[model samples]
Target: MKKRAAFLIGTGCVLIAVSASLAVNNQLESLKAEKSAELLTEAFISRTTVFETSVTEMTNEPVPEIIADNEIRGADEQASAKKPIIIDGQEFIGLLSIPSLGVSLPVNNDISYPLLKMTPCRYFGSVDSDSLIIAAHNYNSHFGKIGMLKPGDRVNFTNAGGLIETYAIAEVLTLPGDAVDEMIKPEGWALTLFTCTYSGTERITVRCVKEERI
Candidate 1:
């Protein structure tokens, strides 16, 4: 009967392990859903006043180029004329919407673990400047489905100042993670958002250009 008792104990342990794993998975999904809801509410409803205040405060500050390494690059006289509005308490630039992909997420000015888990990040450039490069983790709700975007798809960038810039997708390409310098360079005014592939071997880049301002 000793062997029989051991088998029953082993079965109990296996059942306990499976239950714990299932609980953890449910919690993670709940957290993801909660975070997405928070972003949608913040992007569409709240934070409008906060963004306007941020714009006023940063209106005179220099528009520093934020490179891949977060270094301030050479000055663009034209860009410097506009203010860099990402303030201490108010780091979010605005909401980025790709209707085709059903992506409507808040955009933080800086890339960090806490910020990325909550929303996409503006790694470099700005809405009013030459190029804007945003990044996100390859979650299904984030930039994971960006590969499905085709040329001519519309991408909307809504700034804190209540201004919306509509962009037309121009190209979707993949590049090595080491190509930070090349990625930040703008051929002209454009918007770029990237996420790593599932294997993390390369970055999938979606490039868009301003088609209209509203």
Candidate 2:
């Protein structure tokens, strides 16, 4: 009986140690994500400033004559216009802001495990198509608090071209992590934001629609 008690105690200690270690590791990861997001936001701001300046200078120059219909841009050229903005060796499509959650982060053009650790990434569509989907880790400084947002809350996406699109939260739901088809469906939503639940078994999905401006 004494031997059994000692064995149980040892197991309890091991469990406690593991739990503590995991908590510490999670905190460190959250901090790292927050720092990365801050740096990316700064870079985005600087890039936007330069772009605006360039546009201003071009406005002073004479406008080029329009080409004939047959000489218009090809499909391939039109697609190239939607390419992601490359910044510091990373491809970013835009910046995402959830005013209700007090969250703003740079959005990468593609999603990967490593990229999610740095900032939110485009999970599905494009801003121009009005079917954008974004995914991010559930770090406290990231999309962790997105679930707190309520219907009618404001969300905004500023594309690389400096076009700001506003959206109003329409719905919030949870779907299984494997519900890829359902999550990416663009039939109704203009923008979708999702993050894994704390348990990582499910996703917290937020759906938003474009807010018409007067």
Candidate-wise lDDT, in order: 0.68, 0.77
TM-score of model 1 vs. true structure: 0.66
Among residues 3 or more apart in sequence or in different chains, the pairs in candidate 2 whose N, CA or C atoms overlap within 3 Å are: none
Model number with the top TM-score = 2
Question: Candidate 1 lDDT, tens digit per residue, 169-206?
Answer: 99999989888876887577489989987678889999
lDDT of 2 at 142: 90
- Model 1: lDDT of residue 10: 100
Off by more than 4 A, model 1: 1-37, 49-90
For 1-214, candidate 2 gives per-residue lDDT tens digits of 9999999999999999999999999999999999999998878767762233222211222212221121365776445435667888999887787766667788998789999999999889877687899999999889999999899987877555444567889999999989999998657798999999989999999999998421
Best by lDDT: 2
Give the TM-score of each candidate. 0.66, 0.83
Instruction: Give candidate 2 regions above 4 Å deviation.
Output: 50-83
Cα error, candidate 1, residue 25 (Å) = 6.1
